[model samples]
Target: MASSEESFLARRIDAEAFPLAVVDVLALAAVLTIGVINHNGVEYLSTNTVGWLLTLVPFLVGWAVAGPLVGAYSAGAAESAKAAVPLAVRAWIPGSIIGFALRASPLFSGGFQWTFGVVVLLTGGVSLAVFRWLFFKLRG
Candidate 1:
């Protein structure tokens, strides 16, 4: 059995995962925005705000939904990079799929491209893995 102090400390550490999720979303948003600019030019962002959101929101929603489902927010994920990085990458696979599905849907503006999906999978996975690894290193 755990003592109260130990349990409290564990809870404190676990609570930090929430911020990881937020950062994951932010990191992916930046990556997605950069991707948009790379293909459509920077002016596209300013002139087509709705189009940008249409591009952005689905991925964010996908990550938000998939992270918890994949145990990305569990206490183990917050403990170290060895744990978090794989979880982050595993979470990204389904998250990207969901995002691609949402983007291909008629409600959104973009259609799914295999190349785009591959790029997002790779970039998002790398970004999440790097960030989660760095986050644990820094937290220590």
Candidate 2:
């Protein structure tokens, strides 16, 4: 039990994972803005930080969980560190699956479809690519 706790704590403090999580959260925020639009044609998009954060909860949860589970944030993987883009792409698979599942809950009004899954996959991969690249570069 102590070993498990320690492992959990170590993962929680991981520097690379921390930034990746932030990137995931921010990416979903952007996705919500770009993927959904007011058909009414507002001159500008309004900011609702509270509402936006609420909507992002599922994505954030998925991303944070996926990194540790998939070894995306594992220490000392030199080859993966050298190829962050592929790592990002691979990590996004399970990450987005969890995101899709959570976001599909009835709590969210946005209906999930095949295309939404694809959008989530693409956006998440792109998002992780940029952030993880930065992480690898900085870590080096």
Best by lDDT: 1
lDDT of each: 0.85, 0.62
Clash pairs, model 2 backbone: none
TM-score of 2: 0.67
Residue 13, model 2: Cα distance from true site in angstroms: 6.4
- Give the clash count for model 2: 0
Candidate 2, 1-140: lDDT as tens digits:
46986787565345645555565556656765555454312233455544555556666677677756665655432334464466556767887788788778876645568987887788767876776576567767
Q: What is the TM-score of each candidate against the true structure?
A: 0.85, 0.67
Report the backbone clash tally of model 1. Answer: 0
Highest-TM-score candidate: 1
